[model samples]
Target: IVGLPESLHAEPLETTTVRLPRWVGGSYCWAGAYIAGELMRAEGFTDVRYVEADRSVDQSEWIARGETDFSVNFPPNQIASIDAGVPIKVLTGLHSGCLELIAKESIRSVTDLRGKRVGVDGFNNSRHMWLTLMSAYVGLDPVNDIQWVLTKDVKPTELFIQGKIDAFLGTPPQPQELRAKKIGHT
Candidate 1:
């Protein structure tokens, strides 16, 4: 069922295990992928496994290299993979606009991000790309103006909390943690 988007609902396929990748621990971007794995196991479709899993910037590439069966990726990465002939397709849009830009109180708006340290999971990652677009919209030079700090799997929000960075984009758990501690303003 190539590119059918019915893998979850279709009849069970014979396989030892199906591998799925999570960007990070229960992050909003990859939550659907994780849930799908759990659902597949619950439905007896296949034994779900996670592989090549890390906070690196190339989950799409992992899929292209046959390291995993599927992944949850943002549009820019997916499109770039497809352009590189990765032989992958968008199964569905899980969710969008879930990432929240959490910044210190001194920072007011996207425009104010100029010359400030903005933490991201990785360069050109979903968080970075979205923030870059936001910077462009506010007439800031995305590349030259903002200082992007890469924390990868280390959690940029943690660094932000420690005052090592000025701003950062947080997904599910990160944002929740920030809110619970009343750390930063969104």
Candidate 2:
């Protein structure tokens, strides 16, 4: 991406004369993937379609529906999709260790989450799935040992701030926002 002129970035993943995949989604976490798509378009892949997916699970579903040729997703969601027979395979991992689980002072560690309420936008979403793996990593039963608090359309951070949830694993801007407010410990 070095010296990639500013103007080129303005029109990333644009539909073109050549097609890479019918549908591909982007997450803010992986800007490189988007850049790759842009480069492909620059190289004459004019027919590549772009999709905006808020969560990796959505990307998996789009793939299952034949609306997406490829996508990037977390391993837990990827495995779940495959187990659910989504007919997609992992080409490679983009990255990991980006999820940060934040909690109030009452909760000091991952193990402390047992018998506690954790917030998520919904079940099986990015936050919930990541938190599930984290719970298992600490030898806790994700399904039974912890209470999953769903905010539904409401962002979990709001619930976490209001003390409705004991903890939440926010991906990016939420963590930064929480840090600025000095609201929780991560």
Candidate 3:
């Protein structure tokens, strides 16, 4: 009943068709989707399937192109995809208080980031979108005000560890990992 529609509640217990559910990150990040899928299966969906994608692939594109039935991602990225003609719908937010912008010891506050380098997965991805928004909120240009480092092959955590970037915006495991190693501060 959690993720199911009211229309589905009264439907007969029979074979139903659904596009494969897709998600990003490891099991913990997508645990809700998996649990919901399993619940649907228990409720008599005989053909439910899930498609787990690698981090590098754009999971939103999977949903946009109809390769997936549903997925969770940063709201900004989803909105960008919708603006770009992706026929996807945002159901709801799963949780909050997970995303954190971390900085090394030398960088004490947001204002300290002027002329500093920040690392993100890509130039226009979800993390980068937030970074840009935050920069603008602080009266920074988001582009010319700070140096943006692309962490395509290398992750933000690794980039921070290697002293390649001054700050990084990361989520969940990355934050946890950084904390475990005492890498940065939020």
Q: CA lDDT of each candidate?
A: 0.78, 0.75, 0.77
Per TM-score, the best of the predicted structures is: 3
For residue 38, what is the lDDT in candidate 3?
A: 75
TM-score of each: 0.68, 0.77, 0.78
lDDT of 3 by residue, 146-176 (tens): 8988888977888899889999887778888
lDDT of 2 at 70: 72
After superposition, the stretches of candidate 2 with alpha carbons farther than 4 Å from their true spots are: 1-27, 42-44, 52-57
Q: How accurate is candidate 2 locally (lDDT)?
A: 0.75
State, as a TM-score between 0 and 1, how close model 3 is to the true structure: 0.78
Model 1 agreement with the true structure over 24-132: per-residue lDDT tens digits = 4454456677778878876675678877554554677787778888877777678767887888888765447787889999998999999999988777666787888
- Tell me, by lDDT, which candidate is best: 1
Candidates sorted by lDDT, descending order? 1, 3, 2
Give the Å shift of residue 122 in candidate 3: 1.5
Model 1 gets an lDDT of: 0.78
The local lDDT score (0 to 100) that residue 22 gets in candidate 2 is: 27
Ranking by TM-score: 3, 2, 1
